[model samples]
Every structure is written in C-alpha cells, then in structure tokens.
Target: MGRRLIVGTTIDRVDDKSLTENSAAANRTSLWGGRFAGGPSEALARLSVSVQFDWRLAPYDIAGSRAHARVLAGAGLLDPEELGRILAALDDLEAACASGTFRPTVDDEDVHTALERGLLERLGSLGGKLRAGRSRNDQVATDLRLYLRDHARGVAARLVELAEALVEQAGRHVDTAAPGMTHLQHAQPVTFGHWLLAHVQPLLRDLERLRDWDHRTAVSPLGAGALAGSGLPLDPGAVSKELGFRTSFANSMDAVADRDFVAEFLFVTAMIGVHLSRLGEEVVLWTSQEFGWVELDDAFATGSSIMPQKKNADIAELARGKSGRLVGGLVAVLTMLKGLPMTYDRDMQEDKEPAFDAVDTLELLLPALAGMISTMTVRVDRLVAAAPVGFSLATEVADWLVRKGVPFRDAHEITGKLVALCAARDCALDEVSDADLATVSEHLDPSVRDVLSVRSALAARITPGSTGPGPVADQLATAADQLTTWRNWTAESVVPR
Candidate 1:
C-alpha cells in the first residue's frame, strides 16, 4: 500500500484537466509510453505547470498529427488503413476537445502525452504506432510556431486598426495649432495632427516587424525529432505542405531548440508596449486639470474614492503599468535562453508564459487605446490658447526680421532683446506698443509685430510637412492614403475565412 501510494502521488495529472475527467484514467501510472523505469516523483508532478499550460496547444498538436499522418502514408511508412485511422482519430480528438467531451489523465505530463493517450483510447493499439518516428521535441516546437504565426497576423491587423484611428483623428485636427515640446518644455508651434502622426509612424514600423516575423514563423519544425533528424525516410517537406508551413526547418537540433522567433516577437511587442506607454502618459497629462488640452471620456476614466471631482485616466495608467510587465516578459525569456545547450531544455518551457503574456497584453491594450482615442475630446481652443503662452511665436518674429533684411543671427538677437523688453513691460510681443518694441531695438517695426500673431506665424511656415494649415492638410491627405493602403493589405494577407 505504501509503495502504491508513493508511485500514485508521484505521477499525478494536471488538476485543470482532472476536475472534468473521471478518477480512473486520471490515476494512470504513466503519461508517456511508460518509457522511463519508474513514475515521476509525486511532488515533482504536483509542482509542474507543463500539463496545465501546455494543454492550450492541443488543437495545434492534433492538426500537426493529422498532417504528419498524411505525409507518413505518402512516404509508405503507414498503410492506407492505418493512416485513415490516425487521421480519423485526430479529427475526432479535435472535436472532442473542442466540445469538452475529452478528458486528460493525471499521468499525462504534457499535451503531447494527453493527445497520444486519447488517440490510443479511440483507435486501440494502432494509435501507439503513430509515434514511431516522432518525438515531443519537434512536435511542441511546430505547434508553438503555428500558434505564433496566427497571433502575429492578428496583432498586425489590430495595429492597422489603431493606426487608422489615429490618422482619422489627426485629419480632423490638422488645422488645430498646439505647442510642440523639447525636454518637455514648450519649444515651438505644431499642428496637433503632426503630434498624432509621430505616434502613427512608430506603430507602422512595429506592424512591419510583425509582418516580417510572421513569415519567419511560417515554417514547420516537425520531423526533426529528439535533437536529431529522424532515422526513418520521413519527408519533412510533405509534412510542411500539409500543415500549411511554408518550409521545413533546416537543422534538427536548431529546429527543435530555436526560440529566436519568440524572442523577436517579444521584442516587437515590447517596443509596441513602450509606444502605448508613451501614449498613455501623454493622455494622462493632457487630461489633467493642469494641462486641460484634452478631456477623456467618463467611460475611459475613473473617479477617485476620496475626491468627488477626480476623473483619473485609469485605462491609460493600467496600460502604462502593463508595459513594465511586457518588458519583464522579454527579460524572462532572455534569462531562460542565456546559457542553454544546443537542443531543447526544460528551460524552454518558460518560453510560452512570456509569449502568451505579451500577446494577451497587447490584445487587451490596442483596443483600449483605440477606444480612448476615439472617444476622448481634444479641446482645440485650449490647445491653441496654450500654443503661444511661453513666447512660442518668438521664432516667427525673428524670421520676419530676417525677411526685412536683418541678418538671421542679428534677427535672432533682436528677437531676444524684444522678448526681454516685452517681459519688462509684463506683456506679450503682440501686446507691446510699437514704441515699446523700438525701445529694445530700432529693428522692431509695427510691420514686424503685425506678423507675430500665432495664425500669421503658422501660415508663414508653408514648407512640406510643416504645421501650417496648408501643409498640415496635405500631410493628413498623404496619411489617409497610407492608411487606406495599410487597411487593404491587412485585409488581403490575413488568414482565409
């Protein structure tokens, strides 16, 4: 009894699976083909997250198996009847798992073992032969690659949607003047559209990265079994084709162990998170009473418990906080991969949690960001009012002086003296009397002050990509065309219905 108890405790199944299944199969001695001499230590299995987390890949695993079965039959490894049984069992197993009719055993260490056991239960001993040339090493890698491929496409699509929203809002606000910042200090005048475009450009690069990574993840890593190529006359290309993989992995060890794709995806996600965090920070500042340039919707904001008047940008704040976690996820994967051997290690098991977390985090964040942006109201009057609060039009005054035959350096110095004179009089350049402006320098003419207003200053900058109304409108139109092209591409390259 004591020995039985010892063996039973060491080979426990995943709890998340066992709750729905019966106790008999859940108490099985081994999850694998009983290859090892004895059962795993009970304490070890209890502490394992393998079965619990890996089961999420069951659908992909079943799909890969069906593809492999077809390739095996093509290579004359399995007879037609055997192939039919395997394929049929795979389909049935998929439906069972999807509909919650399948139950995993406690002894099933990971998704691979649980799935094979299901096949064996359904097809009798014939299911056992399916593992003849396959190993979990290649199987898990293939499943993860397929899963990430799908997710990469999804993430890119969402990015396009968010980018389109930004462009639309920017187009509406193209003529609205605002202050541009340097070191968080008001430096010059810029249209609000230009600010929005700055963010759209970064996301566009991020989307491109996802698109490229999607192709890199398109290959199948199956048939590279157990740190080396399988001994059988297995055709990996056939498996790749059947499983929708663009190509087969080149080296067996690298194929089984390579997690650079995950790392790359995570890196892209981290950069995206950083972008989101920056946006969140801006929204937080803009909505505060101190700034008051924009007002967040009540739906996107929260009220404080103690302060009845408080409306906090909670969603944006959460997005900001989640960026730390996304960074942590990238660091975690790097730590796991830092000193590993050539082939797959148990350390590789730590890979999915980070990838899954990053993907899930972005999925939640992108839509929230789009919502906040779409619903929030930008106070154009407030933005414009703040535009020239701190001598923002000083550059325009200098340029006006330069146009009137003053050397640029001399014009810049004259503008500085004029600013100091206005400061002494406790007034703006526009507020200073013509005689008062002349007190600082003889160069300050009534005509120079005439072009110093914000609108006049902005209209003078008609260069391409400038914040002048005409240039801003042109930029918005160009951004609109790019958004249309992006939308069409996202619709085209996505998975088929």
Candidate 2:
C-alpha cells in the first residue's frame, strides 16, 4: 500500500509497505509500522515513552497543531472544512486533557502520540491528515520551547511576588539594627532593613536572567522535519507568529538538535535556588534561640515528632535542600546534551523531567519562602541589643582615629588593642577608661568614645550604600521604586501573556 503526504501544495506518495517494513525491522511503532513485523519490545517501549512527564506539554502541542493546520490549509494541503474540523478536534482534546477526563494510555508512547490518538478518535480519518509534512521531532521541539516560554513568564511573576514581600519587610525594619557578620563573626552593625534589601537585589537579577532566557527561547522550530527542513510549503514564520514566537529557525538541523535554551533555563532556575538557599539559611539562623533575631510563624514551621520543645525551620531547610536538586537538574541536562550528535536523538527525551522538576521545585518553593518571610516575627530589640556587641564598633574607632590625623595602620592597631582590652575585662569598647584608651594610642582620646554607641556607629556610616539611617532610607526608597517597576512589568508583560 502507498501513503500520500501534502508537501508545499504538492502531493508526495511513498510505498507504505517498504517504510513500515524498514521501521518495524528497527522495532518502531505503528506510526512507522508499514514495514514493521512487530512493535517495540515491552522494555524498550517503557524506556522510550515520555508521556508521563511530557504530557504537561499537551496544551503547547495542541497550540502548535492548530497553527500547523492553518499553514497546511494555506499551502492548499488541507481544505477549509478539514482545517476547521482539525482545530475543533484539538480544542476538544485540550479541554479533556485539562479537565483530567482524558489521559495518556499505556500504549501511548508520548504526548504527541496521545494527542494524535485523541485527534483521530475525534475526527476519524480526517485527523490522519493533520500529521502531513510534520515530524514528531519538529513537533516536540516546538512544544517544549512554547512550554518554557510560557512558564518562564509565570516564574518571573512569582519572583516579583517574592521580591515584593522582601521589600515590604525591609520597609518595616528600616530603623531596626542587627549585627552583620563576615566569616561567621560580627563585623559591623547594619539595619534589619539593609539585611533584607540585600536579598532583594539578587532576586531582581534572577528576574533579569529569566527575561534574557525568554528572549533567546522565543524562536520557533515547527518546520524542521526530523533533522532537515520540511518538504512542505508550510510557512514556519506563520506558525511562529501564531504561537507567539518571535522568529522561525534559520537552520533545520540546529533547530531540531539545539537544547541550549533548556540548559540556560536550568541555569537560571539553579541561580534562583542558590539565592533562595542563602535567604533560607538566614531564616534558619535567625530563628535559632542563640540568635533570637526572628521567629518563624507557626504556619510556616513544623514541630518535631519526638522532641516536645521543637519548632523546626522545615520550610527553610527544604528550600535549602531543593537548591541542590535544582543544581542537579542543570547538570543532568548538560550531561544529557553533551554527547548527542547532530539533530534529534532519543536522549533528548530525558530533558523534560529535569526541566519540569526545576519549574515545579521553584514554583513550590517561592510562595512558601515569601509567606515565611512575610509572616515571621522580628525581634527588633534583640537585634538592636546584639548590634553593638563583640566590639562591632572597632571599625568606627579606627575611622574616628583616622579622622583625628592618625595613620590608618596605627588606627587599626589602636582599635585592635582596645578590642583586646574589652575582651579581657569582659566589657564593651565604651567601658574602657580614657587613661586605658590613651595606652592604645593618643588619638584614642576620651572624645572617641562618642562612636561606641550602636546608633552613633550606624550614623557615622553616611556613605552611599552604607548602613547609616540616611543611606538605608535612600536604599529602601530605591528598592520600593524598583519593586514597583518589576511588579508593573510582571503584571503587564508576564501575567497577561
């Protein structure tokens, strides 16, 4: 028997028996069954199927199919009636898939196969015409791109929400001081607002990365047939436009083979995970009794089963742990693509799970992280109390000495000796006598004690981006404005799309 396919307004026929025989000898499915004497082995079918994870791409696949049907009609391949019927069938299939009434069957090899089966069931022989001049290779590649583009916008929106939460919390704590650390030891005094704003900056960068990734991912691959350009007169540009893609692929071989977008997205998500993990670590530490800086809301925390007094930071810990998983997702995709040759390969099927899991993990993580941060209780008094401890004012002492015309190296030595005196006497730098201060350096006069107070120490840092009240206020205002811009952008650019 022979089968005919529409190619660029012309009909191309093939000897189905020979093609099927060849494909079956290779243990392919009925979609290429004419030459096949048998289906794939059970183990191979199980191994090759991707419907389990790729089924989430069902809507994108249907969108691509609708566009392809229009192009086919424009090429004079599908009549108006057939095109309308195909589109209607796809709409019905999409509804069923969304409602959970329809799902992939055991024999459905992948999302494409499942949807093709659904279309066939809906339109009977008419559904068979829909596959003309298209290959699963091109179809899947296009669908994955569409899926990522759409979800990347969604992720951006969620990130904006988290950023808003951080900014709001920062505004609430603008005057609340805390001990800032370097190498896990107290280094300086900083407002709680400054600490929170520190996290917001990285999140803004994460949003930028997502936007860049989306820009590169907006190209379509719909007309790349297998590993070569499609034989049909179907317009890849038209399909790209219909699917909201910015451009069509320039090379069919690269179009089908390239997965750099997936890798980039994974990298962006992994970066998001890394940022969140840092924030989570802070939450974990602040909630500890030793720090006593913040308390997690009961709703966002968990109690231990065996320990009666335990209220654990499970959400933050999970956010931290899931960061590793996100990195693993990036590595998995990179490894999968590293050895593949030109064009499509079976290994590409492994790409969906890692990418999908990355999305799932971040989507699950962001809301929880936002809620945890928003609802947590801040111990402002405790923070202020700890802010000036551990000789955090030592730098202020050095700066005061430098202002008094002492060499900076001498000022540093004077401050280090004063810190040692305070340590030996179990007192603060402010408690040192004026006579004791003179022993360190004559520049450390009684008047230098003015900088020992936490408020004075913070006030002295009036430089831009410093923790001074004026600088922090400026930072907070800038953060608020930037956050408003991002939120507006997300609402206008991402949400509607």
Candidate 3:
C-alpha cells in the first residue's frame, strides 16, 4: 500500500516499493532512518503528520535554510559552490511554495521533511549537506519565532486600524451625550465619544503587549540541535542576523524547549479577543431595539433567513463568539507544555496549530470589526434622549450640593431622597419642582437646577479623562497621537515580503 501525500493542490501516492526505489526515500521516512527497517506505521504517520497545518511555516523554513547554508560554508562544511547551489535550491523551493506548485506528500511528516525532500530532488547528493548541523527541533523553533515575529507586527498594524476607527468615531461624537452605566443601570451622563474611547484604551494596552512580545520573540533558536548545541563551529549569530532576529539563544536546552514566546503571543491575542468581545457586546446592545444607540451598516450586517425585517449584527456576534476560541488556544498551548520535560518533545509539534489558529482568527476578526465600527450610524438623538433619564443626573445633583458647603455624605443623602421622590412621582429628577427640592434639603437652591440638564451634567465632569466634552476632546487627541505613533512604528518594523 502507498502513502498519499497532499502537495499543494495535488495528491501524490508513494508506495512502499517506490519508497525503497527512490533515492530520496530516506528524506521522506525520517531524517534519521539508519536504524529503522520500515516506514512509520499508518497510525503513527497519521499522528505525526503536521504538514497540513504547519505548511504555512514553509517560507520561514526556507529562510532559515538559506542562512544555515551560509553558516555551513563559513564552517568549512560546504564548499562555496555547494552553499550557492543550496541557496539557489532553497530559493526555488520558496518560489514553488508561493506558486502552490510544491506541497507535502503523505509520507512527509512535517514541513522540514517535505522541504528536505524538495531540496534533495533539486540538488541530488549536494542537498544532503544542508542538514548537517541542524535538527527538526531547532528548525521548527526558529521558524515559529520568525513566523510569529512577522505576524505580530501585522496584528499591531490591524489593531492600530481599529483604534483609528474608534478615534475617528469618537471625534465626531465628542459633544453627543450618552447614558453611561454601572452594573448595566444608568449611572451617569457621558458623551458617546467617551464610551468609544474607553474601548480604544484597552486596545492600546494590547498593542503594548504585542510590542513587548515581539522583543522576546526576536531571539533565534537555529543553532540548538535536538536539545543540545550544534557540534559544528557554525555561527548561530550569523543565522540570527540573516533571519532578522535581534539575538541568539543562550542555552541550547532552553532554546528548543521554551514555548513561552508562543504562550505569551497567544495570551496577548486572547486578551485582544476579550477586549474586542466587550466592545462587540456593546455593539450588540447598542443596535438592539431597546437601546437604539447605533445601527450597523447594511454591509456589515446580515438579514435573518426567515425574517423580512431582520438586520442581524452577525459580525459583532462572531467577534463575541470567536473570543472563546482565542482563550482556548492559549489554554491549549499552556496545557500541552505543562508536563513536558526539558528540551523538545513531540508535544511541541502541537503548539503551532493553536498559535496559528489565534493568528488566523484575529486576522479575519480585526479588520471586519474596524469596518463595522467605522460604518455604523450612531443614533445621537436616541442617546441624548436616554442620557438624562433614569436619574442619571443624580451624581451631578450631589456634586452641586457639595459645592454649596454641604458635606458629601449629606449631599449624597439629599440626592438620594430627590431620586426617591422622582421615582415615587414617576418623573425625572429635573422635572421635580423647586419647592419639592427645597423640602428635601435647604442645599437644593435654585442653583441646583443648573446641573440638572444632561448637557450641564456632562460639562460638570471636567476632570482629565472624564466624560466632559473638553476631557473627551483631550482623550480623542491623545488617542489620535498614540495611534499615529503606533502606525509609524508598525510601518517601520513590518517584515518585508
């Protein structure tokens, strides 16, 4: 029976007889096949195969090969012609990968195995020298770091796009009053822009985590071969420089074993998911008939199959749902690495799928979320109408009393009684008569009516980062500057194609 491999868009079947007949069979079997009498069991092959998902690492693997070939030439392991030939073969492999002409065969267990076969097919015996001082353990670790380092910058850029959308929307609504809530009950009057900027602040922190994570991920692990330092005097630093890494591993064991970088990346991504989910929940609420605070654009929304009037916020709903998958990815990596011993294990192979999943998930999510936010129509009239209801101006009333020389505790009591009176009369605090207010407390002078309006309530919150127009305007400017700085950083740091 033959093993069926999926190479790019084609399926290749390599029989046992063909495996023995082909000179490159050893490349497909195991990089170390001297002791094995036969190929891997069908079950083992099925369990070990990762070329399906890890094929995305092909470019990084090729990049590492090019650098490794140079290091080999420097170490006197390969002649100049051999190094040049190897680099050329790697370049060809990368092109084939890009064109979707090269793919993994079923017998190719992982990307390293698949590429090695491609190299050997291209260079005959000369390609064999490329693996001299490298091991799959080190190769994969280096490739993952390279992959993540590039994608982290991409994620950073996308996050900035999202933040930019928020800031733009906030700028438009700085003067539009909205009801702010605590425990889902109206607690204060705030500008709609303030609420939007709150989401931006957390995204800024997520960007910081990504920048910090990138610093840690920039260390290369190429010279750590199968849990030990390479025996050859090859310069790992040379490979690190070639691959855009800022540094090389200090300890070989730690180099191959450390998946902390992947976990950290996942954690940051999960935190991003959580933050986006919170915003998504708000979007879901705001678009509802009861809230009526915003409406999703037709492009970002979908119609329910059976309902003629249905405009479902499917994008926001998906953003909320996908957050669980992001958290699950982080948890999966942590659990897989928890009991593994020092150095590399087969279990480490499980790391890429979750990490890659988180990346793919966010890559799809962030841009759509940005578009949803950028195009949505904010119902400023509805927000303004709701902002002053539910006794949201109670806090301002208390503050007015405090300004009248009443202690805050007494002021709170007076405001509470006013709120109670309004509730009993089924009226708004502002609708309460001056006589009724004075009966509640002598502090309730005519000046008390000054802060009763929602506009006045928003204006009274003049502290930094408050919901007042001035503070929110300051926040909007700060957000714009911060986003610009991050955008510049992303453009400067992005990995070249």
Best candidate (score: TM-score): 3
Per-residue lDDT over 1-497 for candidate 2, one digit per residue giving the tens place of the 0 to 100 score? 11111011011111122111122222222456678796788898878766766777877788888888999999999989888888888888877877666666666677788788788878887988888888999898898887777777667778888888887888888778899999989999998988898999899999889878888988889998888887789899988877777899999999999999999999999999999999999899999999988988899999988998999998999989999999999999999999999989989998888888887788778999889888988999899989988888889989998998889999888889888888999998888898998887777789987877888887777899887778888988887787677666555331111
Q: Which stretches of candidate 2 lie over 4 Å from their true place?
A: 1-29, 492-497
For 343-453, candidate 3 gives per-residue lDDT tens digits of: 888999889988888888898899999999999999989999998878888998888878878899998998999999999999987788889978998878777778889
Global Cα lDDT for candidate 1: 0.79
lDDT by candidate, in order shown: 0.79, 0.82, 0.85
TM-score of 3: 0.94
Report each candidate's C-alpha RMSD, comma-separated, in the order given: 6.7, 7.7, 5.1
Q: By TM-score, is 2 or 3 better?
A: 3
lDDT tens per residue, model 1, 77-174:
88999998888888888778766677565666778878887888889778877886788889999888876776666677678778877888888787
* Best by the lDDT measure: 3
Worst 10 residues of 2 by lDDT: 2-11
Ranking of all predicted structures according to lDDT, beginning with the best and ending with the worst? 3, 2, 1
